[model samples]
Target: MSHILLCFTCFESFRLTARNRAVRLSSVGKIAEKPVIGILGGIGSGKSTIAAEFAKLGCKVIDADKIAHELLEEPPVRKKVVSLFGQAVLDSSGKIDRRKIAEVVFADDRMLASLNRIIHPLVLKRTQELIEQYRRQNQVKAIVLDMPLLVEVGWHKRCDKLIFVDCEQKIRQERAEKMGFDKKQIKIRENFQISLDNKASLADNTIENNSDFSAIAKQVTGIFSYIVDNG
Candidate 1:
C-alpha cells in the first residue's frame, strides 16, 4: 500500500488499465519527422507541469488525460459511462461526476477494471486517430504523450524518449490534497499503476521535481535538449 502511495500516484485512482503495444500501428513517416516524447510519473507528481514546460519550450503535447476528459463529455461516451456506472454518477447538470465515479470505482478493483474496460478502449482509439492525423498532416515537429498511464497502457512503446518526473512523497500528498483528495483517496489513486522504481527505471531521463521552479525548469530544458539531440 505504501508502494501504491509512492508509485502509481494517480489523482483519480481508477484510470489504470491497458493492453499490449502491438495492437496499434504507428505511422513511421509522421512521427519520424519528429520525435515523440512520453511523460511518465505517478499522479500529482507535477507530470503535467513538466509536460507543459516542454510545451513552453515548443513541444506538441498529446495530452491523453485531457483527451480522456473531453471524451467523457461526448454524448456517446457519456451515455456508456452512465449506463455502466449508473445514473448516480451523473450530476444535476447531467454531466458525469468524475469524483463520484472515482469514489465508487477506486474502492473495488473489479469496478475499477470495469470502468477501465469501457474508457480505455475509446480513449486509445481516439488517441491513435489523433496520432495518425498529426502524423499524416506532418503538422507537429515534436510530440509529447502526456498520459498518466503511459507505461501501463503500453503507449510508452511509441515514445522515442521517456521522461519520469520524480517528486517527494510528502509534496505529492500535498498536491493530491490541493486537488481535493485525502490521504486515503490519494492511496486509492496510486493503487492501480506499476511501481515507481520500475517506472523510473524505464525512463530515458529522470527529472527531480522537488526543488525550486527554476531548477525544475532547467531540468525540463535539459530533457528537451537530450531528446532533440538524440532524436
Candidate 2:
C-alpha cells in the first residue's frame, strides 16, 4: 500500500466539503432532510409556548429571543451595546442592564431600530451556527425559528415554512399581565410589533393559541408532521 500524508487543514476541508455535499443533496430531495420552520407572532402571542410544543415533538427550536438573551452576556456584544447606549446601560458587574435598555428602546422607535440594526445580524449569525450544528449531529428533523420580528425583519424569506401564533388582543394583554408585565409597558411593547393581520397574511399556517395548550399543541403537531412528510 502506498503511504499518503495529508495536511490537517486539507483533511479538514475535505471532510467539510463532503458533509456540505451530503447536506446539499439531502436538501434538494422532495422531502428536505431538515426543514426550517419559522414561527412568528406579536408580543405576548404565545410564540414561546408554540415553540415549546414543537420542541416536544422533537424539532430543534432555535429561539431568537433565547439567543438574544445569551448575546447580552457576551463581552463583545455587551461592549458594543454599551458604546451605543452608554455605560448607563451596564450593571455593577459591567454586564448589560437589560431593563434600562428595554425601557429606553421601547420608548423610542429610532433607538429601538438602531438597537436592532446592531443585534439582529449577530442573532442571525448565531442562529445559523446553531442550525448547522444541529444538522451536523442529525438531531434536527426540523428547526423552529421562534422570532418575534420574523415578518418585520423579513426573516420569513429564510424560512421553508412560516407559522403564526395568534390570539385576541385582550387575551394577549391578560397573558402579559400574568407574566408580570405592567399593562402600560405591555401596550407600549405591543405597539412596536407588526399587526397580527399582516403576520397572519404572510403565514403558511396559523395556530390559534387563545384557548387551551392542548389545542395549540395539536395544531403544531399536525403542521410539523405535514412539513416532515411533504417538505
Candidate 3:
C-alpha cells in the first residue's frame, strides 16, 4: 500500500475496542467555517499557554492531554492499559500512574507507539466532537488544537492554520526541568518526534515565546485577528 493508505490503515487498526467505548473516527464531522488552528512546538514550548491565550479571545481549545487523562480513568481503558503495560503501571489505588507509563513509553519507541495507538483514536473522536460543537456556537471565534503530536500524526491537515511556538533550547530545557523532566528525559521524548526545524517550516505562522507573557499575548491577539478578519 501507498504511504497515505498505510497511515490510514494503521490508524484504523488502532481504534478503541467495543468493550473500551469505541469512537468511530470516520463519522466525525469537520468544522465548516471558523479556522481550526493547530499548535506546533518542541517540548515545554508553552503551547498550552498559547492555547489559553486564544481561549481568552473566544476560541475553544481542544486539549488532547486533558482528554487523554480523562480517557485513562475509564474502566475499560484502564483494563486495556493494564493488559498492555501490566499492573505495574498502576498505583496503590489501581489508578494508572501517568509517571510510570511515561517512564515505560519514553524509554522505548515501540512502547510509546503502542500506547499512542490505543489513545490517539479516542482523542481524535472527542476532538472532532468539540470542533463541531464549537463550529455551531456563535460565541466561539475559532478552534485551537493544543495536541502534542499534531504534525506527527497528520492532524495538521485538518487545521486551517498552524502556529509554531518558537523558543530557545536553553529556555525550553529549563521549563521542562521545572516540569520534572531532566535534559536526558527531554531529549529522549523529543527524539521520537519530528525535529523543531521541520515543525516550524510546516507552520503558517510563528510565535516567539522566549520572553514575557505580554509579548505572547500581543502576538496571539494579532494572529487571532488576522485569521478571523481574513477568513
Candidate 4:
C-alpha cells in the first residue's frame, strides 16, 4: 500500500489530454496501434482492482511490477544483480531475493537507485514488447498499464490517456491500515511518489474511488465506455 508494494522501486516507484482519448504513440518505439491507458493512484487506492475491471471488460492488462519480478529471475539479470549488490541479495537458490534486496535499498538511496537502474530498463523493455504484441495482434481491444511509478519514472509520457484514481486521504489511510499499514508507514510509502493532486492534474480523466466496489465498477465502466467509443 505504500506508493507501490515494497521491493517493486522495480519498492519504489497519466493523464490524458486531447479529445480522441488515446490514439497517439509517443513512447519512441514501434507505435502501438491501439489505445494504451495508464492507471495512476497512490498506494491503497485500489488501482489494481481498477485494472482488473478493465481486464474483465476485455482490455489486455500488463502489470510492470509483475514484469519486473520476472526480470529479476532471468539468468542474465540475476548475474548482473549479484555483480552489483553482491551475494547477500541472493537466496539459497542463487536467485535474487527481493526481500533481501528491499532491506538493503529502502535504507539506502544509492542502493535503491542502483537496484532500479538494474531492473527498470529490463521491465520497460518487456512492457514495450507486450504493447507491440498486443498492437500487432489486432485482437486485443485495449492495453492497460498498471505501473505504480508510471508518472514518477516518466512512462506517463508514452500513454495515450491516463486515469487517476482519487480517494480521500482519510479513507485511503484506513484502507492501508486494514492492509497492515500504520499512519506513519502510509506516509513513508506515499512520500516516495508524486503527490495525488499532481497526479490528478496530469490525468485526462479522474475517478473518485471513495465508495464501494459497485460504485467503483460503475465509474470504471463509464470511463471504459468512453475510451472504447472515443478511440
Q: lDDT winner among the candidates?
A: 3
Q: Which stretches of candidate 4 lie over 4 Å from their true place?
A: 1-33, 92-94, 177-185
- Give stretches of model 2 more than 4 Å off: 1-31
* Every candidate's lDDT: 0.72, 0.71, 0.77, 0.77
**Which residue pairs does candidate 1 place in steric collision?**
9-43, 13-189
Task: Determine which window of 10 residues in candidate 3 has minimal summed lDDT.
Answer: 1-10
Per-residue CA lDDT of model 1 for 56-121, tens digit only, reads: 876777877666677788998888888888999888998988778777777777776777777777
TM of each candidate vs. truth: 0.83, 0.81, 0.85, 0.82
**Cα shift from native, residue 7, model 4 (Å):** 5.9
In model 2, what lDDT does residue 219 have?
Answer: 93
Cα deviation at 72, candidate 2, in Å, is 1.7
Candidate 3 regions with alpha-carbon error over 4 angstroms: 1-32
Considering lDDT, where higher is better, how would the candidates rank from best to worst?
3, 4, 1, 2
lDDT of 4 by residue, 104-203 (tens): 7767878778878888777888999999888877678889999988877777778878899998878878877887667766776676677787778778
Best by TM-score: 3
- For model 1, the superposed segments whose C-alpha errors exceed 4 Å read 1-31, 136-139
> Lowest-lDDT window of 10 residues in candidate 4?
12-21
Between candidates 2 and 3, name the one with more favorable lDDT.
3
lDDT of 2 by residue, 1-231 (tens): 001100000001112233433453455455447877888776668888898888998888887766787777788877778888998988898777677887888777677767777777788789889888887766667788877666555556667777888888888878777766788787776665566776676676899988987888889889988888776
| Candidates in descending TM-score order | 3, 1, 4, 2
